[model samples]
Target: LLQERQLIYDFMYKHKKTYSVGKICKYLKVSRNSYYHWKSVKLAKKKDSRRTVLVNEIKRIFKNSRQTYGSPRIQAELEKLGYKISRAYVARLIKAENIRFKPKKRFVNTTYSKHDYKIEKNTLDRQFKVEQLGKVWVSDITYIRVNDKWIYLTTMIDLADRQVVGWSLSKDMTYENTVLKAWNTARKRRQIIH
Candidate 1:
């Protein structure tokens, strides 16, 4: 409805010199009072001095934060600067100004290939699909933060069924706790007929 009003306003504005206001309003089926009201509101917004200042300040704060500050943080900063603004309003302004923030990536390096232990050969030759259960198994280890401490998780999956045959969680990444424990659990759960 607002868009239709805007289109009507634009059409009337463009053709105002050639056509009278009453005729245009009657043809468009809109009241002249509503058109005048919308024109007044738009002009008042354009004449607002605070909008320009706020946009500049918002851009400065966003740049100072290295483009990492989101709407909530930006709102807090604006409040600190004696401007009481809502987070939603700040977000809307940011979107209108085409401001974007970079998202922080959560990644942990769990694998360290440089070690004294012998590296095993790839026996599967990259062929992951298996014809039968227990024929091919894969394992992976990852870590999760728990209570400000890291807990390692190990999982063993059977390729045929694509199910987690065994899993283990430990505070340390030791072989006996992670890989060995998961392997022991897998052996107990499913028989390997090699």
Candidate 2:
């Protein structure tokens, strides 16, 4: 609008006898008040064109970092290259360009306790706190979805320290699988109780 007003003002000044402010405003499809206001304000010099180049470099850095960097990181990277741009400037540039990084996906739990195999009663119940490290051992079996297929995993945890003493993963979730995992866990821990 300022540039259009400047052009109109220049044209009117060149031919003031024939063209008036009202006539120029009508030709430009702007109101007389707007034209007057634009005429009153002094036109400032155009902004530097180097900002576009800097913004492009910032965007390149963001893309190269897999779009994981935010304004601060991007500013730091720019500073490393001797670009003395401000963080606020980088943030404004990103906002004006509507550029944003994608968020990471959430981790999903894959435990499935529903099965036909006779589930042993929770012998340890919730009594996880034990006096000694090897006093009580708790075991549970879970299934993992790998490549759209189910893989069973059995783990024996020491109730005292909540440490996974033993674990076994298998394609089948049968009684043998559960027993084998328990046996392996006991063998690894050198526990006599079977």
Candidate 3:
């Protein structure tokens, strides 16, 4: 393929400090014009990678913020995470991605003020031991890349059984697929005699 020469040219460029460019081009069957054009493409790819990372990070943080964060807040969060970005730059990135964030409003607590919602105590206390098979089930979700697609894998394991009781996969990391489905399956498989 014609792109093969371009790849070889890139290989040479990566090692240009140690290898001779002329010999590499000759050996790889890439012409000088082809190498030069490929070089431009490589440079563009480098820039594109950085932009891609920035855009993805912006999207993640924006999502984690419940889509309520705009460019200013997103830029601030990125800065906190050690990324040097400006609000204008964030705005431009969002625009380029055709992303729209909700305008931030003042926080309002909608929970009943008089009712006491009891927080469950951590009875496990970092202990993994369980005497009953259906007692303790631990669940976690992870993202995996399959070619160009991202897959979220959720697995639940019974501590006493020491086996995966249930599992679910989805394109995006959402609780409906990961938590709900996995939980239902785990409950059925474990067969806790209520």
> Sort by TM-score, best first: what order?
1, 3, 2
TM-score of predicted structure 3: 0.43
**Model 1 misplaced regions, further than 4 Å:** 1-110, 114-117
Error in Å for residue 153 of model 2: 10
Candidate 3 residues lying further than 4 Å off, grouped into runs, are 1-7, 18-29, 106-194
lDDT string, candidate 2, 1-194, tens digits: 66766787767656767877677777767778765565455332122346777788889998987787899999999999998989999999999888898664477766667878888787777776797867787778886767548888888877777878878888887767775766576666756453
Clashes counted in candidate 1 amount to 0
TM-score to native of every candidate shown: 0.46, 0.37, 0.43
Tell me the tens digit of each residue's lDDT in model 1 across 16-88. 8999999999988999999899788877887566778888989999988878899999999999999978899
- Give the range where candidate 3 is weakest over 10 consecutive residues by summed lDDT: 104-113
Q: lDDT: which candidate is best?
A: 1
Error of 3 at 192 (Å): 43
Q: lDDT, candidate 3, residue 16? A: 92
Number of the top-ranking candidate, with TM-score as the measure: 1
lDDT of 3 by residue, 84-175 (tens): 98899999999989998767556666456576788778978889988888888888887686755779889998899799998898887677
Q: Rank the candidates by lDDT, best first.
A: 1, 3, 2
lDDT of each: 0.89, 0.76, 0.84
